[model samples]
Target chain A: MSSFVLFTLTGLGLAGLYFLLASGLSLIFGLMSVLNLAHGAFFAAGGYTAWFVMDALDSVPIGLRFIVALLAAGLVGASAGAVIERVLVRRLYGQHVEQILLTIGLGMAAVALMGGWFSYDPRLLTQPDWFGDTTEIAGANVPNNRLLILGVAILFFIGLMTFLKRTRHGLIIRAGVENPSMVRALGIDVSRSFTIVFALGGLLAGVGGALGTVYFNGISPSLGTTQLIFAFIVVVIGGLGSIPGTALASVLVALTQIYVNNYLTSGLGSISVVVLLAGVLLVRPQGLLGKAAP
Target chain B: MKRSSIFLFVVAAGLAVLPFVPIEVPLLFSGPFDTPGTLQVLSVALVLAGLAMSYDMIFGYTGLLSFGHALPFALGVYGTNLLMLEASIPYVLAAAITLGGVIVVSLVLGSVALRTSGVAFAMVTLAFAEAFSILVISDPLRFLGGEEGISLASEQVPDMFRRVVNTRNIYWLALAFTVFTFVVARVVVSSRAGRVFEAIRENEPRVEMMGLAPFPYKLASFTISSGLAALGGTVYLLAVRGANIGTTSADFTLSILVMVVLGGAGKLWGAAIGGFIYGILNLRLSTVATSNAIDNLPEWLSGPLSEPLFVLGVLFVILVMYAPGGLSSLATKPSFGRATRRS
Candidate 1:
């Protein structure tokens, strides 16, 4: 019973991070039709920013530190996204390969620059005093950080769903994804919409990264590559341009990963995940909730 | 003035004489003294070049962006290692087994990965490769030798020729492989079937409308490309003196698609040149930079970006900004950069 609860909590916590990372990638692809490989870099950057902020303000209260770090990461993500969208991504719209290459390049540069700024050794964000302490929940010993992650994930899903469904910008985003050419033709300034989407996506990715530092206990230069691969896998499994699908798939993948890790040998566990993914593709080429091709 | 014949003659002469030159200075233009070390380097280069060339068979010819081409490479290397260590098989038999193994694996994996196109295909392949890497790296009965990796005794080359393999002979072996691959790839590309591959690249729907099943073509290419990639892995193992689970095969960047793009995907020569440049940059240039002192640069700038991820970024940037069609365009002196006005 304890093992089951532990596995479930772990899965949920990881799913939150996955949703944070993959949501941005999915939204970007939906709006731009381009795969931005560097989305993972934003996640890494956010984590680093958070870590830096906390270190610089070493004496601050843990609650204020968390808030300040989260805000810093979000702002950095948004500013970087806006600048990148205007200067680079705008020219490479519709060119999927170029976009992948460019983002991958940017990701690499970010990692290298990070290594230069912060040594190769990994850095971790400290958990708040309230969250650092462990708790026994439903007969299972759970880390407060894990609980925080789950709460954040749930909150993010609710907030994102609400924003997309109830807001004017959200409606514009939906319309853009459905018929981008039409949206542009209608003089809705689709470029402006794209910039906003990119920034929002980056913000989410940043927050995910910041949160991830608490879960993983650290972030490294190479972490971006690993996270990038994981995020890409989640995006593929969930179906592009579908937030609901991303959320569900994130949980599914996390659950499967945790279950496999616990139940099977590590080698077989990985193979099983791949096999499961392959099975999914063979059954549903467009993903579980993906729109059927015309 | 037979241009083709002259080109062949020049290539043959360069390969034949390149090893006799002094060992201290790497030949700028292929003369004597291209020792066993150089030959080993060349062999590894040819192997990678062959893999890249075959990758072009799918990626370049079919317009499929598969980030998972490394799957076949892993299958080939690990399969050959198993054959070599478990069966105590000779190199000749082991090579054939590895090739066959990769073909089967590719067909099975491709059936699943090839179901989708564009980004979906790329994602699925990448996922599979990741999974495969994890499987090999994870400790399971030490079959993949786990983290320690498996080592081979030696190749089954004739005893007399073994001496020739020092550095120069290895270069010859590499050259022979490169030449053989170049010839085979060119012949395949020039065939009627090659035209079908090209058509698939241009428009799959149009080709299907003409009553051709694209799956078979893709499967065939996947198998053939995989077979060649396995052969590349085999050569790489021999050159490196052993195989490790995490080194190249498990590293997410094993089957470098960017190099293929940088070199020119469809062109065999492009693959060769791409591998050659990569080798030089990785082995010679990195070594020099690491060893030599840089004037007035910060200490951080001087460190080796030995991590594959670091170089990949730079390579991606160069490929994206400068040569979309690859380095083959540079070789052909094509007017590429002139057209993109970047509004």
Candidate 2:
């Protein structure tokens, strides 16, 4: 029973990381109608940025460094997203094949560049000394870092929900998701909204990648491909453009994966989640949370 | 009697006669006309060309992009592998069983996924691919062989094929299959069904209004395309001597779509050319890397500046931006007449 509880908590923590990675992908996909294969590259770049910051400022307070690293990831990812959108993706509007090809190219280029620069060695992200310590809760010991990550993920969700509901830009972005053409007809600066949405999505993915680095204990160049697959599965399972649906689906996927990993096939745990996704997609067609109509 | 048939004869005759001379002596001449390895590579190219032809049915002709086609290809490879290894079946029988399995699986996936359109359809296919890849790599150990992948025993090839199924035999089989598939595809694309697929690509609503179900035809096309792709994978395993998780199945990057575009998407001959180009580039790049020639470049670029990703990426971007019709457009000029524009 205690083992089950521990597994559930671990699953929830992993779900938080998945949420961070997938929500951005969902948001961008909703607004732009573009499958940014390089979204995973942004996630990987975030982890690398955090690694660089942590390694360089050894004397800085560990907690402050972690926060700084998170911010830096968001900033870097947002900037890159903006540049990519303006320079390349802007020209690819309405051409699905072009968008796919370009983003896939960018993703490969990023992987090759990172592999060359990082030399294929995986890097582990360390938590501050305070968070590195373990604590006991409900007769099960959990690491402080994981608890912190969970809290951050929840905070991000609430914050994003509020922003989407209350802010003008957020509403416009939502509107864009519904009908990009309509947004343009209304004389809203749809391009700026696209840029902002792309950056925001990148920022979320970056932070998720950073947190994932801390949880997973290592980051590698091939991390993008692995994470990209996960994000695609999440989006498909959750239904594209549905944020709440994505959140629920992410948790479900994470839980299935965690439990399966521990109890079933071990190394093959993620396979169950993928199978689940396929099953769900088969039944729902549009996705679990997909809109009723196209 | 027909102009096109005469043109085809002339072209075929020229190609068949070209190998008599050394490749360096003429523009069309290629190296070692009689070598087994060359024949083997040509066979592989033919198989890939067949795959590209099928893939282009959806991507180029029908304007539907599918990411899950790789799943059928992988299944085809593993299906044959499993039959030979566990069931102790003959290679010919195994290939047929695998081909049937490929078509059935395609039907199942297409039935559900074809319901969606555009990005949704693409995403669904991707999901299936991920699911299938994971199943093969992880659990379902009975069928997938896990990550290690199932190997072929030397005794599996039939007695009739044993002596002949060497590099040359395999090459001949691949060439025959490619030619057969190309001709069939040419017929299909020029037929009523092909006209429907093209119509759907141009305007789905108009085609639907014209009394075509659209769904059935799309599903049928998807199934046929998938079956051929699986055949390609099966041949690959036989020729390469075995199937691994990565090697047998097409990677997402080089998904047969890349071959489709490289060859000239809508044209069958272009697809074959695309396959040959892909094969030549891939083989030669690896050779170049291991060769001493890479030593002269800068330290950063010295190590294999000829990565397929770089070539593919550049080609993809350029083709999408400029020649959306693909490379075959440059050669065929189907839409343009000789005296109209070019001097």
Candidate 3:
């Protein structure tokens, strides 16, 4: 029973990481048809930036250092996202396939550059002593990192929801999603909103990456890619553009993976998640929460 | 024959007779063209060209951007290896059996995956392939070697493929396979079903409106492409004499997509060209990475220049941006490629 509690919390932590990626992927795809294959690269950028900052700040206070690292990662990722959009994606506007291909190339190139710079070796991110400790919940000793990551993700989720509901840019993004041409017909430039979405997506993925280092225990060149696969499954099963759907699916996938691995065979967890995806896709092609395709 | 076909035949003939020629190319090769080292590289390149052509059948022509295509190819590799080692079967019989398995799996997966369209289809296929990759790496039964993978038993291989010394025979086999696939793809691309595939790619709803079922055609393309990929995998296993988990990766499928696009999609020969160039570059670029010229560069610049994948990835980006028409498009006009002209 205690093990089950640990598993659930760990699963929630994993779900938080997935949400960070899926939210961005879902929104970007919802507004623009682009799949953003380079999203994992954005995540990696955040992770590496966090790792770098954390390592370089040995003289700084430990608690504040990680905070600074996390913020730097988000900022770097946001900038990178905005730049990639303006340079590569903006040129291929409306050419969905070409845009996707361009991102693929960019993704490949960026990951390889990271590998070249840092190699594939896993690097441990330094955290405060509290991160390593655990808190008891109902007789279960749950790791503090898990709770921390989950808390951070939840905060981000609420913040994102608020932004989406309250801000003018968010309103523009939502309206643009429904009908880009209609929004254009209303004399509002949707292109600026595209840049904002990219930046927002980058920020989420970046923060996720830093938090993911805590979740996964280390950072590697291929780290983003391995997690990206599960995130893709989450996005697809959650339905393309729905934030709430992405959040729900992330929880479903992470919990299923954790429980199945503990109760059943170990590696079957990932396979079962894929199985879940296949089942969902077969039943509802648009996904559980996604609207039916026009 | 048409001028291009005649030229292609002459080139094929020259390649066929290349084994007997002891001539050397200056910059491209470290040894004579027919040497085992060179033949080995050429064989892999030729096999990739063939593989790329096979991928074109579905992705380029039929408009299916499947991310699980590696599964069929990986099946051919592991199935043949396991059959040869565990069952004590000969290579040919094992290969044939694997081909049968590939057909069945592709048919089953295709029917299900084809149910969705656009990005959904890509995800479904990717999911299936990832499952396969996971299963292979997991190895519950312990037959499939985990990450390092399994190799074929030496005694089980045919005489002509027994050792590195027999690389010439394998190279010849690769050349023959490439030609066979190219010819098959050419014939199929111009056939009635092929016309239907292009039509589906252009506009599926319109094709459906014409009272024809798109599912069957898509499935047919899927199966055929799978069969070709499986054959390439068999050739690959023979070349490297082993199968590993990397072959089952989504990265492999993406590379195939890159090859198809880099050459010019919907153009069969263009895909082969793309595949061959990428294969050669992939194998040979490591030499460039370690070369003196690149070593002389600044540390920041030289570091990335040392990685072959980095160079290839950047090249992929530049080409996508500037030369979206691909290598073939830069050479000659695809006069009849009206169906492929969209961005």
Docking class of 2: acceptable
Model 1 spans > 4 angstroms off: A116-120, A129-132, B1-9, B23-39, B155-165, B246-255, B292-295, B303-312, B333-343
In order of TM-score, best first, we have 3, 1, 2
lDDT of each: 0.73, 0.74, 0.87
Clashing pairs in 2: none
Candidate 3 clashing pairs, residues 3+ apart or interchain:
none
* Per-residue accuracy of model 2 over A188-219 as CA lDDT, tens digit each: 99889879888888888888878878887878
lDDT tens readout by residue for model 3, B85-145: 9998999899899999999999988888888888878878888888888888888778889
RMSD for all candidates, in order, please: 3.4, 4.1, 1.5
DockQ (CA atoms), all models: 0.52, 0.36, 0.69
Residue-wise lDDT of candidate 2 within B1-343, one digit each (tens)? Answer: 6786577557555544433433441222234655555555666666777778877777667767787777777777778878888888988789899999888889988888888877667767776777767777765547667778777654787653344335666765666566666667777778999889877777788988998899988987888788877887777776666677874332542446677776776667777677767765655554555455765777577532545555565566677666656677776665631111111
> What is the alpha-carbon lDDT of model 3 when measured against the actual structure?
0.87
Residue runs of model 3 more than 4 Å from their true location after superposition: B334-343
Q: What TM-score does prediction 2 earn?
A: 0.89
**Candidate 3 TM-score versus the reference:** 0.98
Write model 1 residue lDDT over A89-198, tens digit each, in one string.
88777666677767767776677667756767988667677777778878888878888888988888898889889998888888887888898888788788788888
User: Candidates' TM-scores?
Assistant: 0.91, 0.89, 0.98
TM-score-wise, the better of 1 and 2 is: 1
Task: Identify the candidate with maximal TM-score.
Answer: 3
